[model samples]
Target: MGHRARSRTRRNCPSLQEQLVHTTFLEELVFWTVKFEFPQKMVCLLLIMLPDTDYKEALTQAFVLHYSRISMMLERSTDPDTLSNRVVHVSVQLFSNESLAFRMAENLNLLHVMVISLKYMMGKILIQNTLHDADKNFHYVVDCGRQVMKEHCYWPLVSDLNNVLSHRPVAVKFMSDDNLLEMWFTFLAMFQGMNVNQREMTQHVEYEPNTYYAAFSAELEASAYPMWALVSHLIDSSSIDLTKRVLTSCLIALQDWLDAINFTHPHMNDSMQVSFHLPLHRYFSVFMCQAIKHQGLSLQEILPPRDVLTLIMMHPLRVQCFHWFPTFILTITITIISSHLISSHRDMERMSGVTWATISLTPLGISDEFMQPGQRMRD
Candidate 1:
């Protein structure tokens, strides 16, 4: 149904609380009036029970709209607890439906909102040497970490965003906007710095290893791998200038991530195994080659410089080079086509007095222009 018709259907349905009251059989079971103080709880229940109907679609739209609005408000929130709750609501809506996840990213604003939320939560948890009492701060740190993780939103936020960004056209639109693109790199920088602090904290903690910290730290890497991998899909489909820009940013981000992370950290290695299985190494290498071929960029003029290339190829998180035979063949094919076009252009320029004409007749049969042609015209 059209959005207007669907919105009208939603308005005609009972109020959210009434739908909950009717669906839950509260009228038959409760003798006294019962009010739901937490409307999100009721909305969650309604989402679960509502069958296939326009009402469900409307509710889904309402939830997505709510998520969009709240996400924008996250930056202004002062209460961490309130911010966490609002972030959790966004996470719930994102996980509830794939279409909702898509709608959240449709306008490309949610991506930046998510970055702000993640950075805020990470900043809270990464607070180190701020308090004099080590004992009190440890508990506080754990609580901050737990707040963002309450609904599996911590990892799923990055992972699901990667899933939603699987749409190339949407991704390109996102990457095209300078503000949104800057936000993406800013996220990478924030993630890198937060991870460095996390690793240091892991190394310095005096108490026994807390599984909660371990799980949270592990999920951090799980989130990181997907966020890094998210851009690989866009490289092949973008315009040459954009592809160059994206590849450059991606390399710089990867370099920053690799430089900051301690691979030997106990939790980090396995988390890498869990999330770093993406063939981004392969994607970047291949697309870099393709970009070079299309732009006729010499190795000396290639993006990221030769030294960075060496770093990427040698590092633990190095780009895995594969499909050599096909890539080789494709490069050769492109070279031949480029040569042929150059030679054809020269030949076209050498032809003197070459002109193109179309079949023509005027009001007077066979016009003077057509009759006077001895100008090497071809019709």
Candidate 2:
């Protein structure tokens, strides 16, 4: 009887309240599977709960149609609080297609979405470092986040992309520590669009701390242009000048975050007296590495400066050295990569002309020497 009921839910298009009720039951079943030491039960529960491709597509259309219906309902109401209550009460009583919970989510902020993601990380410092919705097991928060943002509002969110829009740091709305973390990661996500759209795939899992890699090699083929259109719209650039403005906006936003983070503030909490320190460069480089590794759509290709590119490429290798090799060995590793990139004139030809100039002008930061007259530039 229990299995038959579950099968019925699978075969039918459940109303919104019914879906949540079923989902809640499934969520509980997962907990019990773990409690009873049934690993396969846990995996089976998760897989079954996921909407298949056709269902996902159908659910997407329903979400947009529901949003329009909601707008009409809100507009007709004389008192919003009373209307919200009536709609919610009726929806629950009837098990209506419009769930009160989904309606309430549209008002949530980006920070709220990120906290959901953090919960799934199991209190680890590192995430699985993925951006695709297909990495559903790894990135559960994104689905919920999308629900909160709503597909209908995706365009509107794009218009307000930058929390900081200028270099002078004008007085802006105060954001809390958690908000700052969301902004940083979301910015990284935008930069890693290529990786999200095109990458080697990971697979369904029996357990997690899931595999970071898998065997599927068929290419995830798509351009980042439409997403780029949203970004270009964010900055209000003319179509011809879109690329330059987008890059400038990103660089400014990066600097803005770096300025906001209180370096002295103890960020990470642990049982021990010591807290894990996130290095200054790692924040930049982690996102940079994701962007750098894109073979299909190289963000690194358009961005200027050979020295910056050199540092971005070396970050992953440096991390490997730090983790897998000794400090002295890491030192030698950096020295070799840096020398080969900078010292060889023939090797420099692969970089743009502007990049070569930037490299030539950079003094390698080795000596405490004074700048030449008129050479010092504004920060």
Candidate 3:
């Protein structure tokens, strides 16, 4: 009976070992299958997210799916404050799709107002960059900054503007000019009645070091057209000596700004680099044309009709260099001729009354002969 029991135990052990080996083989196969499938899944996800086909609905669906998973994770977190802060961060991360992020942010009151203010501030900046009205843009940015201060007691708004002034000295120079004087006055008025540095203005996050600096850098580097226009004006209006001094300083500042914007270390990819030379040249050309028109004592002497024609002829070679060159040449020619014709009443009246008839109607006209292909062949 004992021998029979031992034999039965041995038989059971062999069957158990065989079953374990089969389970281990199945586990290895599952692992390999998952590993092979994940990259393909990611590729499909990227293809679905591609913007070329206007798959906004699909993108929104994907965003919803991602946010649902995030919501579940947030629910599982132990600390409520950590979850609140994370919600704020998630809301901000969603800002790439601003409309959706804003919808999410609207429901979350647990986060500090500072984060909301930053979102609004970023939106204002985006609008200002695209908007046509400078005054309106300024008002919007300043108002958002003021609101941030009022709601969150963040004086970094002032600091942000100050840092922008320092880095883009042109903004300050232009802001001091007559055109922007009213806006500056308005800004001063808004801040005057309140405490400049009221720490307890509202209970909010403490000031982060370099907050203003980072903000200014991001704003300036993102768009430097305002700064460029301001510097160009200074260069145009100043006296010769003053112009040279200002230009030298402006160029140095501009170079620094350009480097800051466009600098790409080896770690950065090609798309990360910025190139502003095309825009700079276009603006500078316009500035030069305006300056010449206003300051030149004798337009006829400076650019005669023949000179204008020559300039127009040279244009074809440099077509890629300037878009407005032909238009400007035409305007300059017309201006010079008008100035000449206006000086003499007799010449003006003689040229004005009779429109010249096209010579194509005449038998000897070359244009008519060229139009008649048979005649051209005979000739």
Best by TM-score: 1
The models' CA-based lDDT, in order, is: 0.38, 0.28, 0.30
Candidate 1 residue spans exceeding 4 A from truth: 1-41, 48-61, 68-108, 127-153, 193-242, 251-302, 306-379
Tens-digit lDDT track of model 2 for 1-379: 5345434433442221223232444345533432333344444444452347443333333332232233333333344344444333322321122232232233222222322222222122222323212233232112212221222222211222221111111101112122333333443332221112111123333343111111000000001212222232223212213333334444444343322331121121211111011122233322222233321224334443544444332323322422322232122123223433333455345343433332321222212232222221110
**Least accurate 10 contiguous residues by lDDT in model 3:** 190-199
| Ranking, lDDT, top scorer first | 1, 3, 2
TM-score of each predicted structure versus truth: 0.42, 0.25, 0.19
The positional error of residue 237 in candidate 1, measured at the CA in angstroms, is 5.8
**Higher lDDT: candidate 1 or 2?**
1
Leading candidate by lDDT:
1
Pairs of residues at least 3 apart in sequence or in different chains that clash in candidate 1: none
Task: Give the per-residue Cα lDDT of candidate 1 at 277.
Answer: 22
Evaluated at residue 238, the lDDT of candidate 2 is: 25
Candidate 1 Cα deviation (angstroms), residue 13: 28
How well does candidate 3 match the true structure in TM-score terms? 0.19
Write the residue-wise lDDT of candidate 1 on 200-290 in tens digits: 2123345532334433353344344543444455443336666666566566555644444422121111111111121223334544555
Which of the two candidates, 1 or 3, achieves a greater TM-score against the reference?
A: 1
